[model samples]
Target: MPKSPETLLEQEFGLIAELVHAHARARPRHPALIDECSRVDFGELDQRMDRVATSLQRDLVDVGDAIAICAAASVNYGVVFLGALRAGVAVAPLSPSSTAESLATMLADCRAKFLFLDEHVAKTMATVALPSGLQLVRLDHSPGVRSLEAWLAPAGSVPVPVTIEPDAAFNIIYSSGTTGTPKGIVQPHSMRWAHVRRARNFGYDNEAVTLCSTPLYSNTTLVSFFPAIAGGGTVVLMPKFEAGKFLELSQRYRVTHAMLVPVQYQRLMDREDFDRCDLSSYRMKFCTSAPFSAALKADILRRWPGGLIEYYGMTEGGGTCMLLAHQFPDKLHTVGQPVTGHDIRLIDEQGRPVPVGSIGEVVGRSAAMMKGYFNQPDKTAEAEWYDAEGKRFIRTGDVGRFDADGFLTLMDRRKDMIISGGFNIYPSDLEAVLFQHPAVRDGAVVGVPSREWGETPIAFVVLRPGATASADDIKQWTNSRLGKTQRLSAVELTTELPRNSIGKVLKRELRDRYAQASS
Candidate 1:
């Protein structure tokens, strides 16, 4: 890791502000951002960010202050984020729909001095007494709270010299905790740029127009956005993901690239309106967050021809494994290979390297790996290791196996594995079987505590439009495809399965609910 002061202004600038400024100078008149209501050129974006930074400095929010961004995915939110980064503040983007209790907990945990709340959420926040020393800054529109727009009006655009450290905390993205309170993952500016460099090397170029259909607060979105900006690409922002609108927007903007979840891809393919749109503009499409079934992968390839790419990574380290479009023929199920500059290993509980075709925990050493969990040294220490050979690695908490060709195949999450009748069953295997049913639109598998088997597999399924399937029928379908140990003991038909903002199944919630009911 290079020292922050010396590395801050390099080609791969460590500071987020430097990334934005580099693009602004290179492409001043280029369209940098486009939301539903507004568009900003690189020049305007740079100037606005300067003004926002000036306002924060004038308000006495000095360098190293933590700022919480709680706004919808809008143009203003992006501006505020860049400004805060430029002012040398650690920016934490809070989910707009997070509960007041969760918000309060996160705010206090991060020790944020300024809270930027969207108008709708601002009103709800006002009813609750905020912790002392925290200032509420309203975004978009709200009464009583200081508006971001109002604050920027008097602050003139004068570029301030910001001293930045590459290793300084840049952002704190809170993970959805399954066992306890959500922990904030502390990512440094240099780590972010490392991913950006990797992304650029993977063919994201300056002329690319990247679409932002995923939530801006998502890890995938951050990975794509920073790289797009650093490479002087335009960002087409969507406030939320809507299957119909997403297809249309891609054509409207001639979007060159996009990142999507498997569910979104399924929904888009099922929509009759999707085929009518001109989707030829998309050149590259990356899928992450969840595994796309082989059939779904084939469908996507058939639909988009050569545009699909599959990547496997976690928030702790970005782009650990990627299966490029070219490698899909030989390794369709593989998460490609370890990305460049990353060392991947599959190790057993004994800390020895597992043989090929054997499942073990996936560990990686990458330049883009996170520094550690925010304020959680114990957890960090538990997650990382230094081998006798002097190599450092971060355990992924995911179970995977490598093929003879060195391709990685994901088995299951270590925490989500089901033990039924003393046999281990991965939920993904059951979920894949359930998705094979034509009537099943979405499915999630969870292990419910059972006195007889120790743990029993249960499934929650959502049906397709106008398709009604009973739980027994779905269970029968799953049983036909899976072995006895992997088959679901019970199935529940629901309108929808609960998912986090990033579209990951909230299996922990399902497990708890079903475990309680069975007890």
Candidate 2:
């Protein structure tokens, strides 16, 4: 029988590096990771990590030190992550998609002495500003950057073992900067262990195969990435998101599990060959990082062969809610209840609990919560909420309400809420109505400055292919169905909605681009 999660946590073999070593011994030839460029088996992966750990020690990088990586997702990056973890070094995976200034800030914040950069990133940094004093090692050969192959320890070298406490710092995941400058959220080994443990409940095991298409830097992808390793399963990664490529990989690998954003799901289902692909091996489909619609969930359940689960939480790890769509078909519209040992509640603007079922800001505390923001106590304090009994919870910045059966139905982000004419309006409610229209492909609404009502919602929409619908036609049709205060001021058509690397719509960008006085 497999070890219980609690037992696994308490045991001496609980360390991720130790677990990788065990897998190396028992299943040396088993393919541990596969990417478009290459494949790594358990034994090879273990040895590579050892070399990385040894090299870090040789460079005088000690426990608690951070190492930064900015590159496209690949098999090489995975080995670097494991190698750093084994050396008791916290690995900070910086998003390559971030602007040069943002990248420099994050690199400086983490203070990573060693950096592993892919060729593309290195070239970009050369033209833009680059962090000084880093022992730069390129993922591939570059003119000025040292090759990663030349920096590794000897093939047979082994690293000295170091004690890793459960509370030891693991990784610093910087936020996506949805509002402004991103904050680095510090996640500990214990918090990550909880994620691995919780993953077993989703049926991850030795035979499982997880397909991850999103960028590795995002927490949305790691929710599945780490578990596949912990479960002793094969992980397939993609360098970038391409609908046709994703389908081919899923069918070729007989991928049994996936953690994708809603936008990804929408594209996959829209593919002409979606139904032709043999995805019978799939057992679970996990989603997070953005909203997942009930209508889309229903469509997947009808066509996709797997249990559909939606996770609602932030990277800061305060609290997470799960909606097991496969189990609660009737509650598809709700984001379901809290997972085991998670506490979720809604609070008014004053930080006081609101009446049950009334909409308010979502606050939660869980075993998987992050330690705090790195080196920013004031920012960390701002994110925290304390109850009368002095129990602590993290503010999710999302507004939602719970039903009689404990299912949560999210309204909008606290900052995203629009107050026009003394009434609060949620953009999600309006977005849902937009999706209902057959001609509407996808849409987003943002509050534009208004002289008459202070702030009114203006929408941007993408029409379905070959569907001819004027902006005025869509605006009139949608406005008629909305409540008096919730109507959109106007609708502007677009070819596509802007999204970040993790597929969350860039509403801030939309508002900035279309900044205009409302009628």
Per-candidate TM-score against the hidden true structure: 0.78, 0.80
Local lDDT at 360 for model 1: 90
Candidate with the greatest TM-score versus the true structure: 2
Task: In model 1, state the lDDT of residue 46.
Answer: 86
lDDT of 2 by residue, 48-89 (tens): 999999999999999999999888788889999999999999
lDDT of 1 by residue, 1-519 (tens): 323322343465566577677667767898888899998988888888998888878778877778888877878888888888888888888766555655777787788988888777786565566777998877676677888777784545775678988788788887641112557888888888787766765557778899887766677788888777766788988887888888888888888888877767777888887667788877788887665667767777777734677878777773388887554665787788998778888889887887778999998887777788888889888888666797778887788988887889888777686654334456766676688899999989888765455567889989999997788998997786564346689998888888899998898888777767767
RMSD, each candidate, Å? 10.6, 10.7
lDDT at position 235, candidate 2? 96
Model 1 lDDT-worst window of ten: 1-10
